[model samples]
Structure formats: structure tokens, C-alpha cells
Target: MQRVPKAALLGAGALAIVLVVVVVLLVAGGGSDNDNKNAAAPRGGATQKQGNGDQGDAKPDASAKPSLTGSALPNGDLSNTRDMKGPITSGNVKDLQAGWSLALGQESQSQYGSYAASPVVVKGVIYSQDLASNVSAIDLKTGEVLWSQQYASPDQGPNGVNVGGGRVYGATADSAFALDQKTGKEIWSRKLIRNAGEGIDMAPGYHGGLVYVSTVPGNNGKFYGGGTKGILWALDAKSGKKVWSFDTAPTEKWSKKNEDINLGGGLWHTPAFDGSGGMYFGVGNPGPFPGTDDHPWGSSRPGKNLYTNSLVKLDAKTGKLKWYYQVIPHDIYDWDFQNPPILTKVKGRPAVVESGKVGYVVAVDRATGKLLWKRAVGKHNGHDKDPFYASKGQYSKLRLNEEIYPGRLGGVIAPMSTDGKYVFAPVVNNSVTFTGQDKDQATDGQTSTGELVAVDLDTGKIKWKVEFPTPAFGATTVTNDVVFATTFDGVLHAVSAKTGKTLWEQQLPASTNTGVTVHDNTVIAPAGLAAGQGQTPAIVTYTLNGK
Candidate 1:
């Protein structure tokens, strides 16, 4: 990964602290009254209501059989050859000898909100964070809530939740926390220095004995008025003690003189780790003010802005930068390059594939950030195009118009799913452009519908793509060679992963962002409706074979 210069690094640090404080206060101040309103509810389907007893210890039905028996396309790479062991196969369900069942649970409101943070399943216990600022533990087999605890600060966003070594780690605003996974008890918490006004929207990546969390400066107080920078922390997983810190942007003496150059790129996504101890992640849009004069377009500051919009490889043990590939050089649009870089193989090569807001699916060498192939997956409008390639920071006078593809939400809003043979990409269609001074005053410009696309993992060819009437926000889950996704119209549909054929469809109460999770014969989704309405978000579980 490239390193930001010293002067710029200092400014970014100051900006990050201020930004986190402001975003926290803003989040904490605004939504307290209606916090409970957005809580999740149960979906209307074949659900098992927990009886008046210890919900966690409920026994599974003797007739219930496991629905899914397979492995996730291990580490995002398809060609790596993992020992597949799940009940699902590539053939049709009717061709199988065994029958399956689905069960629904309306206990929890929402599973995970907004971003695509994969839920952690440890020791048959599932753990995930909710939009309501609560961490919940549920029985994987039965949709029974084991324990849940809400945080005092409503503004704190629990971006990442992971369970390892009997401890669960999560990041809320500028602080990182550890809790007992079984009992949901706090082990310890640590407060990091964030930018005064910007919010830190990142999940912590856990590997080996350390936890890696990303932070953005400038969100401590109000709005993100001040500039921000990106910082990564390595902490002791159990004790919550700092091990080492890597500043993507390092401070410099002359940074104060040039405020535009002082802005640091924000790290808004969780870092991905290779089993061999390599870490990978991307950065968010550049700030304090985007599209400004000081930091002209396509300017790459050495050291300080090393990994923004760039896929970075780092040593997990030492927190050292190894390699990087910039997806968009000096990104202009708010096209954050922070989507989880799914580690998968393409064409029998060990590769890492990532879908960015720019609407491009890039496959690169996992060991070395070498570009293998790049394909535009979304519609391109041709906005800014330049033929001449100038060196980084050397402003080129050449201007060309290029089509803008994918348009922010059109790219991979959800994580990519694979059955080793094919990759399923959920293309979001929420074409509503938000423009306003504040969130409340923002206008919903237009509504762009969403789609689910199946691509050949080996050839990058489209197998089949299905468009949805309403926008689909949650990630897709696969089992028994069938893919499942939910939309805002309160509908759940299951499609064949191999042929993209609709196998099952059902309607619920509202739109859902929580991705579907499958355990045994049951499929679960967490969802909610718009605010001020009499609807609450819910965790709807469904049994595939209903009476």
C-alpha cells in the first residue's frame, strides 16, 4: 500500500478524531426518540414461537433436517478447491432423494443494517449487530434470541461483529468493544482518538491474536465540517490493549499550510484477511471537501493517501503495508472502494475479486495486487474520461467525458455469493439520488429498481439476471443450489443458483436490508418499513416445506 506524506498525515489524524466525535453526537442526538420504532419484528411465515422457557436451549424438531450442506466459495476465490461438505448440490431439488423444510422466526427486528458485514456463526451460536445499536446472539438452528443488549449511545454504529476465542469484538464510532460471546457480557472497551466531527463507519477484522479496526477522523462533534483521515489499529483481541497502529496518512510539517492537501482518505469498510495472515481492505471517498480546488482530481499524495479507493494488502501480524491496487485513481464521485474484496479464484488462478461503486468488477492476484482483468458490470453514462495518463499528483490539462457506470448504489451493494461454480452478484437499482444540505432536507430524486445477476466465476460471463420491482438491499444466501434475496416490497424469493430460475416466492410486511441466513431447513431475514409508520423491523424465519 502507498503511504501518505508526513504533513498530510498529521492533518488527517486531527481530522479523523474530530469527525468521529461529530458523527457520534449527531447520531446520538437525532434518533433517540424513534430508536425503538426501527426495531426488528417477526416475518409472517412458517415460524416457531419461543415458548415460556429458556429460548436458547430449545430443542429442534425431530423431523427437521438440514437444508444447506456446503461451504462458502472459500475466501472469495472460486478455484482454490475447498472440500465441499453441505447438503446442497448443483442439481434440482426434485431430483434429490431427501426432502427439506423451512422455518421462520419473527423474534429479532433486524439482523444487520446498511453495509454488508457477514454474520458470524461460532459453536452453533450466531452473532450479529442491529440498526438499533444492539448486539444479539441467536440459536443457529432455532430463531430463538439468546441475549441482546442495547448501547446507551444511539449514534454509535456497531459496524463489525466477530466471535473468536470465546470473545466477540465490535466497533461503535471511535470505540472498540469485546464481549463474552456466550453470555453477551462486556469484557472491556477502548476509546481511540477520532476526528472531532466525522463518523467512523468501519467493522473490525479479527485474525491471529489481534483485532484490526479502521477509523476515520473528523466526526466527533456535529457535521463532518472538518477534514478527515484514515487510521488502522491493531489491538490485543482479549485484553483490549493497543498492539500497533498504522496511519494510512502520516502527518507532515507543511500540512497546515495546505488545507486541501491536508484532508485524509477515510477507511469505511472492514479489512479482509487471508488465512496465511495477509489483510486486505479499501478506503472511502476523500474529504473534508470533495471536488475542491486544492486537491485536484487524480492527485495521489505519497504515503498520506496511500490506500484510498485502492485494494490494499498488509501483514496482519505486523500491520505493515505490502501491496496495493487503486481501483479509481483519485476518485471524484462518492464511489467508496470499501466493499469486501471477496477472495476467490478465477480461471484457476488465485485471485481477489471486488465490486466497487464505480460499477466495475476487478479481479486481481491475491498474493500481489496485480490486475488480472477488469469488466464494467453496470450502465455507464460517460462523464469524465481522459486518454492521457499522467503521473500521480501531476495534474494533466487533458479532459475527456466518460460514461459513469453503476451510479453509486448500482454496484455490489451486497457481498458476492458463490457455490464454487458460479458467482451471484446482487445489482441494486435504488436510483434515488439524494441531494440536500442535511439528511432531513434531502430529496428522493428518482427510484431505480434492483436486480440479481448470476455470473460465471471462471469466465466473467453473465448466466442470467433477474430484475426486481422494488430495490433489493440485503445480501443473497444460497443453499441446495438455490439463491434467496428480499426486497422492500416485503417479498422473499428463492431462485436456482445454477439457472437463475425462481423456485419459491412469498410476501412479508416491509422492505428488508438484513441478508437472508439459512440454518438446517430454516431461512431467516431481518426487515423493517419506513419511519413514522406503524410498522417495525422483524426477523422472519421460513420453513421451505410448509403445510
Candidate 2:
């Protein structure tokens, strides 16, 4: 697959939140081989007998009936976002097929680029948002085009798509779009700000009856207001009406004028819901803009920016700020804390684990937003001599730059898969560059090479790390015994979840940006260029056969 030419026209904020520090303890645990060995073992004699003589000797339990309809879909209830509901279980595994699986739209050319938004699966239907402010619905099983509807602003970049409450929600560069899930018809559209220049980078998160979206304004192609001021909106899911809005820009006069000061700390990734009415999300970089004196430095700004690069928790129902943990105070390296925050129980403790551009994997208390543990999963590089203050008094110097393992874009960018026993992180290699004066420099460039890692969720210890030949830019999926990942190089790979060994591999025409989704025995990959060039972008489906 070929990389698209750099489009310098518009700004879409970086991905992930700031890197927070956590203390991790290494411990020994069960191995992948041990798990596999037990799975393949024969069942007890009584269970075996029941299976063999099943005919008329046993009656099926009423509660065990196969479900023909989709289970109750998840509402974007902050408290319940982490709870597993419906047919999508965290532990169930299924075989996947791979081909020109599903087609949503004709390839279209645009100035910004092709499509970068990932699609969503809801109740067997696939929902996608493209460059234009529109969302399309397709049949997951048949690849049939169901319907497509356009939102209000065509120029708005619909970066993320989501489905809930029998409604489809899309987050555009300028606003939010809500559509009828069944008809692909627009229900209502709301614009937080008009043509703010910098496109909002996050997908909309739905919880309870509210939709959460973020935006960045005052981006004049310079570094000052070019940085986000951290604007978040909560809207009524059914009506596209604003419920509440929060701003992270500092209220002090001196701080607002310093371009190096925290100007914009907008949301870059979709907020995660805890299913219990709580929401979790991250913020992005501080700015002087792209080319200006607003660069983040000790002398440039005197104090830490509130919520500039931090993990924030909000009441899902009321849009109330609960607690926050700053990952990087007064961030200078363009490290945005906007990655996915996954909620899982680690070592029996309910925790939120997240990755960031700073190359760290951190776990925090989901309810209280308290730090539990953190580890350097990738390489870190930057000025480590800067003095800053945390909740405690003052620290003279901290290690800001350590050539860590994973760079930005995460050791894993996609949401992790877990069986409640282990977490699967798809690894990617990345690099960074810094320029400017010795004290203040502009940083850019991150390259990724892909790999897969299994970690003990409880201890934050690596059970195994397996590298891929090509870098993966898409998402990942897992079932029973296997894990799946697709690369920008137009390839799909299947590996033993237990052994970290490759089970199958297949090549496609273009980069796979949407990741792999499984339906029954087939695997689906959405491949093609966002600009509608080179290889024809189409969905490929695959299935495995007995040798």
C-alpha cells in the first residue's frame, strides 16, 4: 500500500491524551500455552455422556434458546459504557471470512483526503461517516446498501461515526449529526461552531440520552490560538439540542495572551462511557500554533495549563466534571492525550487503561479518576530538565525525554481486546523529530511498524510480544482462540490468541484503515485510499477452510 501525499490544507487535532505516571508491579501469571492446553482438554464423563445420548434423554432449557434478534443495544450511559450488553460478549469467539465484503459508497475525491473515519457496527448494520457530513448504513451480512443521508454542512469533516438509541451519530469537523438508524435519514444536526478552520478529530460518544462532542477554534494556521481551548458539548441524542458545554481555557488574563500558554485543549478522541452514567475522555496539545513563539517552554508560560493534556471524567447524565488527572502539564511536544480509554477490571480492581502519544500505558480508577499504575510501553524523547508542579509541591526536573519503546500513535491505537483475563495491545513502532532553539523546539513526524502484544491486565506485565512485518493503521478484533489485525500495507493477519503465532495471512489492494470485523464465520476488511486513488477501495471478506 502507498501512503497518501501530505495534505496541509486543514488541521485535525492529534490523537491521544497526555502521558501520566503510574507505578507498575511485575508479577508472574498463567501462560498462553497453559490456557490453550486447558481449552483442548476432554470434558468430564458426565458432560460427554450427555452430548452423545442427547436425542430424547434431555430437554432443552427455556433460557438456553438461540437468539434470533439482536440483544438490547447499549445506550451511551456513561455508567454503563463499560458494561457488556447484547450479543457482543467480551469472551465469545467466532470464525471470520475474508473478500469484497461490503460497499458503502462510490470512491470520491476531495481536497482534505479520502475517508479517515472508522465505521461502527450496530445491530448487524454497519454505519460509516466520510469526508462529507454524511453517514451511510449497510447490511453487515449481505453487503447490501441500506441507506445514506447527508448532514447539514458538507465541508464539515465527519471524523467519527457511532450508533445508539436506534439513532446514528456522526462527529464532523465543525459539529454533530444525528440520523435515523433504520432509514439512514437525518434526525437533526447541530453545529458547535461555524467553520472554526481546524476540524474536530473525535468520534461522538453516546451515553444515556446525551451525545458528547469536542471542537477546536481560533486556529489561524499559527501556533497561538491554533491550539485547542478544550471545548466539550453534551447534546440531547434524539433532538440534536445542546444540553451543556464546558471550556478548558484558563480564565486568567496573562495566560490567555501567551501563545505558549494553553489556548486550546480540545477533545481528539471519542469519550468512553462507563455504563454507570460516567464519561471518560482525553485532551490535546498546548499551542503557540504551528509556527510562532507560542511554543511551550518554561519561560514562555509560567504555570501549568488546566486540562490541556489530561484525562477527564464527567457525569454522563449531567455533563458535570467529576475529576481529572493531568498526564502532561503544559505539554510542549505536540503530544495529545486523545486515545481510547478502555474500562476493565485489572487484578479484580475496576480500572481505566489508556495509551497516549507520549508512549506510555496507564491505568486509573474508573470511578474516581485516581492513578493506579503506569508503564513506559514505547520510546520517549524530549526536554527532561523542565521543572513543574504536580498536586504536591514542586519538582525541579523530570525525565521528559527517554527513547522509549512505542512513540506516539500508541504502541496500540485501536481499542484493546480482553477476555477479563488478559488484554491484547496491537503494537506499532513510531519515531519523533524536534526542531527550534535548545529550550523551545517544534516537534513532528511519527512512523509506525506493527506488532501484537498480550499483557496481564492486572499487573501491566507483557505476557508476549509479537511483531508484524508491516505497520497496522486500522483496528483489531478477537474471537475465542484467535486475534486479527489489518495493516496499511493491505494485508490481513490471524494469530493464535494463546500462542501469539500466525494462523493465516492474506493481502489486499490498498491500505486497510477501518480494521477487521467478524460476522459469523467471515472476516471483513475495508480497504482503499481516502482520496480515491491507486487501488480501488473496497471491503474484502474472508473465510478459513479445513486443510
Candidate 3:
């Protein structure tokens, strides 16, 4: 997917999950399409906050806040976000009723099932992409398809579109293209990928005049075995010509000489803008991960993987690195810092906040790239230090399977939402155990649970955390008072942003690996994907029934 505005930073989420997961095979062999950023390992569960020296050009604009109409959602470039203060409050959310249902395609026909893209509502039209990367325009009020751009794209998700500069932008398996916003006609297309093992799946971010699209190391629903490096590109929005490109992979000293040991970084979501021509994104993880049998504990890939699993700030016009703060150093467990870099003002200071599968949400000075604060969400098992110990051959079999919090299918696997003061995250707590630091197979403990956490943007302290029965995926959407999240059980939960209490919940027709959109009195939920035996993949829209 691809456009933010004229210039925008990239945005979140990870993993190609199913109704059930066998992570061992997915990690040690053919990477079951899955996924994050790690720079430096924070010594403890949290990092301290600080002021910065770079009083850069970033200015706060509430009007420029990500919304559905006009611009995109705060995180909605293939993920989700919103600007309108939602009307469904904790008190009134219980009155919501199913309003309209739209099916993108049949579960059998699509590989990734139904919709993975968050619906982008601009003006009165809703722009959405399906599992096949098909773009559609619908009437926001009546739920009618206005135009459809047909495609045969693979179900490599988080794929979606960005509507700006009179064109809608999206990508297929190997190419990126632009479409007329009104007529749905193809304008300019660029071939961005050369192989199935590595391609583009994230929604492109747009701002000022350039569009940002990055290459991911995945082949449809599977990951590249090895040697695939990711690239971030700033393309000319008008001609689809590359303005600049940045290599996400850093040149590292291979632990095994002359071996193909590098599987580099990419993006899971679109980027966010810093108002001051700076584009921000959470970089993906490095691979040949955890370790192969011989290269135990990722010994073949050692040291801090610069730019990988880190928050990279770049000059939107030049693509030059401004600053970066790594969350996990030499990440072995796919703890990607892959959430949308949400921009907000804390105590009059501009800050960028992000969260990844590492289950840690971090905030940094927007201009200085200095750590403001960091807090751990969900669960932790100290497995984050395994790569360090094992990388140095201090391997201990006693530590095997002992650490599994934020496991293979766990942590913050979806995009997060923010309403200035607090950030809302959808976290999956599926515990996964590995045979050892040197082993390839990982076993799922199957203790999969979920939570919605509210973190104070300024202090990095968790304000509240609401638990759920099953894992939640996709993006977290919030109005003024209520936070909206979707669970793997296909239930949409409306939680109190202030209290972390579930105010209302509704079950859909099927399971979900997607997000929700809230506009005015309506909450649009994409209840498509992994439909039950009798259910059809449908996008369910709920309206306040009696309010």
C-alpha cells in the first residue's frame, strides 16, 4: 500500500498468523511469514526519560493529526488511525448495533483471507484494500462500492492504499502503482520487487511531495530463507521514479566467514511525519534468526544491527539519517519496533512514540532522537538477552525454553493508536519455547492471551491495561474517550481509554487479523478472514442503535 499526504513517516504490526501456529517450523525452516526493530538493549524493563539538545523544526499541528476524512488515519496507511473524536463513549458504546456488512472476497479464493487493510474514509468515500491488495471505494454512509480496481496481487499483508494528491497508491507482489482517486484508473506503476522471497507489503507513507515504500523480506505468506536485504525508497509521487533509496541492512562482520548469514530489515507499516520534513519509521528485524543449528543464538549475525529494529529518523527530502534509538540489540526473537511512529506533544516537547513485538513501548524526543521514556507492556521472560549470551558461545542448555514471554506469536503484533496524552496498544501474549539457544525449533506454549494497554506518553508509565480472552491483532483505534480493538476471536472490544475497562463487546461472523475504524456515531470493523464453517467474510459497521 502507498500516500500519507505530501510527506509522511512510515507506520506497524507483524507476523503472518493463522488460527493455529507452529512456530518451530516457521522459524527454523521456511519462515512462516512473520516478523521487528532492535538497536540497543535497555538494561531493564524501562528506560529513563530525558530532554534533548536538538530543538529542531518540528511543530505540533492538531489539524495535521491523522484522521479518516481528508487525510489518512493517524496510523492508517495500511494499518489504522483517526482524527475525529469518536462519539461512542464508554457509557454509550453498549448501544452500538451492526449496521452494514461488506464482503471483500471469499475465504477460499484469497490467500490471506479477507481485508487486512484499515478502511480509509476521506470526505464521504471509504478507501479500502483487500487480502488480494484490491483497492475499492465505498460510500461511507450507505456502504456502497463506488469503484473497484481489480488485481491478482498475493495476500502479503498488511497491504493497503494511501489516497492523496488526487491519486490512490498501492502495491502488488512486485510493483507499486498510483490510481486516480475519482475514477480508479492506474496512473504510474513502479517495479519495486524482484523476488517472492522479498517484496513490498506495507502501506506507503506520503508527505510534502514524496511517497515512501519499503521492501520486505517475505514471499507471500512465507519469509525468505536467507540473504534478502530490505530497502526503503522515497519515490516521486507523480512519476513513480525513485528520488532516493536507503538500505535497511547494515554491513556487519559475519560470524561465519563467506556465508550468506544476513537477512536484513524492512517495514511492516507506513511511516509518520514529524511536521518538520522528517519521516519516521520502526525498522524490521534481521534474520537467520535465533540461529541455525551451527550458528546457534545467531552467532553468525552478531553485534548491534544498526538501523534494524530501531527507530530511524530521516530527512524526508534527502533520505539522510537524522537519529536512531535501538530497542533490542541483536534481536533474535523478532521483537520488531514496527508500530507507527506516533507524533505527539509532551510537556510542550515534540515526541515520537512506538511499540513493537518486543512488548515494549518507547517514546523519544522527535527532534533529538533521544529517549524520553520506555515501558514494558504485556509479559516478559528475559529471553531478550539470549542472543547476547549465545552469540558469544556462552551457550547454556539450562536456559533453553526458560524464556518465552513475547514469544513467536506474542507481543504487540498490531499498530498502536494515540490521542496525544496516551498511546493504546493491542498486545498478543502467546508464549513460545525454543529447544535451546542453538536449536531451530520453537514450541508454542499455547498460553495465548491479549490486552489493551494505555501508556502515558510523557512518563512512559502504563496508565491502564485491559485484558482479553484471545490475542488481538491489527491497529488500535481511539476516539476522545473510548478505545477500539479487535481480537482473534473476531470480537470488537470498546474499552475505556481512561479506565482500561471493557465497556462493550460484539462478536463478528469470523476471526480477525485486522483493525477497526471509528467515525462519528459509526464504528467500522473488518470482520473478514478465517471465517467459520458457516460464516462469510464481511466488513461489519455498527451504529449507535438507541443513542
Candidate 4:
């Protein structure tokens, strides 16, 4: 997302803050510590390591079973890969033919709304939402609409949709709801957040009879204007009633006595739930960006900004903070820890992997939040040039207008995929010049490149990387032999997963910023929303010509 630059109330410094907010939207886990009585079991299970990074001879936890509502890939069940497994073999995916196409909603540039999420396909039906948060269910085989529901508010664009507890779940600007899966009739809709300026922008997660939704502030300080804020909420999946809520920003440490500038730390992605009742979520950055005049370095509402720009694990049933790992503390770069933390086994040990706008992908011990290994995946000019790249004492340098590679929009912003052994991440490489003017708000007009890199989950080592002509957004899907990546320019490229060789490519209807889902012999994806490019939101399907 892009924005018009804003000027600071106090002058240039204010504009710097304004400049920072635009980059904030460009886009956008863990476990441990405290305690959750309902937590399944310490994620630490004993195992034997093999010479390969893949899990080998690991004793399986009888309790760890496939999460029916977890992310589903066409290859097989996502949970079946605890040993770093992958599709048995790449199917006959080559020589494809376009299947049925459906228009979910009209893309609106004025509203900044587009169909940007991957559709949820379950039980022979496809569930999705458009930029306006219009919810719909379509037949998986025939692009026929089963049911459609529209929204009047532009703020209601849904980030994604989920299905569980015999209902379909989705979150709009400020509310979370569940609709009858078959009828599309609203079962219950709850305003999870009071401030209209704050809304839920990630797909809801379900487990143990509970549904989870996270909130993100409106663009361009809509949150600050309404004196709004952010939080993580849990609800009864069956009834949409509030269960427990966790404030991303707390008043005790993050507030200004006289001002209303305390904000930021929006959750912009889906929460990962371990079957054991441990939930992992990533928190966004702190507010007023760059820094306000009062606090030049953006440390105004400070104290490590508990929970902001960190990976948090909570007890699924009680929303109790268990443990957290802050990736970027007092983040001035708007580097959101917005990516999902993937729960998997590393060398026979339970581990969590996450990557963010900082270009570094990390693996941590699930129960302890201890670093296993961190590797820089995306391309960057150099970290030495980043003003806030200091490993220690980043707060000392609160200077304004410093340049950085993998600059706000340059790092990895989309979701990554992982087979039991390797993690597939789509990388965005570009240089961002932060100018606090209404003109150059962000990478609104900058050029960016993309790369698809495969990293060994066990060693954090790069196996193979393929670069592209345009920057990549959305999610990456992997089959046994092919890795599917959609570029910002609407080109869906299928590269050989084992060798990074180009296998096939298809041009979509519009700029695509989401991932491609291949189920069985069919591939499903949605196209809309490209920063400066106008949108024509549509769901595109592709199937093996003969299949």
C-alpha cells in the first residue's frame, strides 16, 4: 500500500513522521515463557537427528495431529510434514490451461481496495472476500457463485478468510464474523475493536473451539486521529463472542501523559496455532513513525515497546502471554514483524521460523524463543548503511532521514512456504528514500526486483535462489518439484523446486500480490491491488490441460 506524504505539525520533523507513516502500510510468533495451563505440552519432544537437516527418526507426539483448519496446500495436508516432507512428486502441472474465472468485486483505486488474499478452498467450495470485504462462496469446480454478501463501508475490505467450526470466518476493518458455510448467512458479526480507525486485517485462526483475529490501524494515522489503537482478540468460534483480548500497546509504558501519540504494533498476518493450544503471532511497529518532534528518534512512547515488532506466543485458550522475541526493538524503520511464524521440526526439534521486512529469516526454539539461527535471505546494498541496523543500542541513533537497503518496502513482505526441509521465501529488493512530503510518500513510484529463495530449515543455509524482474508480494506455494510465486506485475512463475529452474509461467489479469494455491491438479489465485497499478480484481484458476 502507498500514501500521500504528510507534514509534521511542528515543521520538517512532523513531515518526517508523515513520511514514515506511508511506508508503514507498504506492508506490512513464538511461544514460551510465562505460562498457559491449557498449553498442550512443552513443544520440546525428543528426537534423533540425521545427517540431513530434515527431521529423521524423530519420535512423533501422539497428541500432535493434523490441524484440519490449518493452512491447506494442494500437495497434501500441511501438518503431515513434521519431518520436513514435501509433495510426493510434482504432478503433471506443466502445459496448463486457464480454468473458470470469477470476478469477486470491482477493484477500486480510490478506495485502495483489491482482492489481495488467497482464497480458502474447502469441501468442494471456495471462500473469499474482496477489497470491500464482500464475502462469497463459489463452487470449486465450476466458478458458479453459491452465495455473495456485500459491504457498504470501504473500510471493510477483508484481509483473508478462514473456515472452521462448521462456519466461514472473516475480518473486516473493525469487526470479525462467522457466516453459515453453506448459506453465506451471517451467523454472528462482532466489532472486535471499538475504534473505527482500527480494524482486523489478517485471516482469523481457529483451534480448540476458539477463533482468533488481530487488528491493524487504519492508514495515514486514522488510528491516531480517532485516538484508536491495536490488540489481539480471541472469540468463541461458534458464536463470535469475545473470549480474551491482548493489548499490543499498553498504557502503563507506552502512553504520553499529555498527548495521544501512543500507538502502532498492528498485527498484519494470520496467527499460527500449535495443536497444543499455543498460539503464535507477530506484532507491528510503534507509532508516529520515524519520530515525532518531541521524540526525534521515534522513541516518544518507548520502553522496548512491549509486544511491538515482536513474535509472541500465548496460551490459546486464555490469551496469556507466554513468551516473546522482539526482532526489531524501538523500530524506527516500520519493519513490521508481520509474517506468520511457521511451526515445524528442525533436526528433530520443535522450531518456529519467521521472516520480516528486515531481510532476515529466523528459526527459534518453539518453547523458549531462543534463537536457533538467523540468516539474511533477501538482497540488500549493505546493513552498515542502515541508520537503525545497530545490533546493540539502536536507540542511540534517532537521527532523521537516513537511508537503508531492504528499506521499509524492500524486505520480504509476503508470506513464505515451507516443506518439512526447506522454507521458500519471496524476497523484495529495492531502495527506499524517505522524504516527508506529500509527494514521495513511499516506494509509490520506485522500481523493485524479486527473488525466490529456498533455505534449509535445519541449517538456515540457502539451497537455491531464483531472481525475477519485478518485486514479489503475497505468498509462495511449493509442490514437490515446483515453487509457485506471483510477481507484482501479475506474472505467476512456477520454478522447479528442486533446482530453481523455470518450469512454467502465466500472466494474470492484473497485478498479483498474493500467493498461488495448487490443489490436486488445479491452481487457484486472486489478482488485484498493485501499488501504482490500477486493479481489476478477479479469481484466476489454472488446471493441467489434460487433468
What's the TM-score of each model vs. the native? Answer: 0.73, 0.74, 0.85, 0.81
Backbone clash total, candidate 4:
9
Off by over 4 Å in 3: 1-19, 22-68, 73-83, 107-110, 251-259, 391-393, 397-399, 436-440
Q: lDDT order of candidates, best first?
A: 3, 4, 2, 1
3 or 4, greater by TM-score? 3
Clashing pairs in 4: 8-14, 8-15, 29-281, 29-311, 34-322, 84-420, 84-421, 173-199, 481-497
Q: Write the per-residue lDDT of candidate 3 for residues 274-347, one digit (tens) a residue.
A: 55777888887776667666666666777776677889888889999999989877777666677667777666
TM-score of 1: 0.73
- Model 1, 1-547: lDDT tens digits are 1100100011122122212221221111111111222233232222222222211111111112212222121111222111122443334333322112112223322222222233444445556665333566665555465676555232223244755566677766567788776567788888775656544545566667787676665442443343456678899988989998877645342145444444445555456655576777766544332223443442323223445567788888888888988777544444556555666667777677666555566778888899987766545555323211322343454332322344333455555556655666666532212232121221221444567877776777788888886545555666657887765454677788877887766554334444565554445454433221333444445543321
lDDT at 26, model 3: 18
Instruction: Give per-residue lDDT, candidate 3, residue 485.
Output: 85
The positional error of residue 191 in candidate 3, measured at the CA in angstroms, is 1.3
Q: What is the C-alpha lDDT of each candidate?
A: 0.49, 0.49, 0.65, 0.60
Q: Which candidate's TM-score is highest?
A: 3
lDDT, model 1, position 499: 79
467 in model 4: Cα distance from truth in Å? 0.8
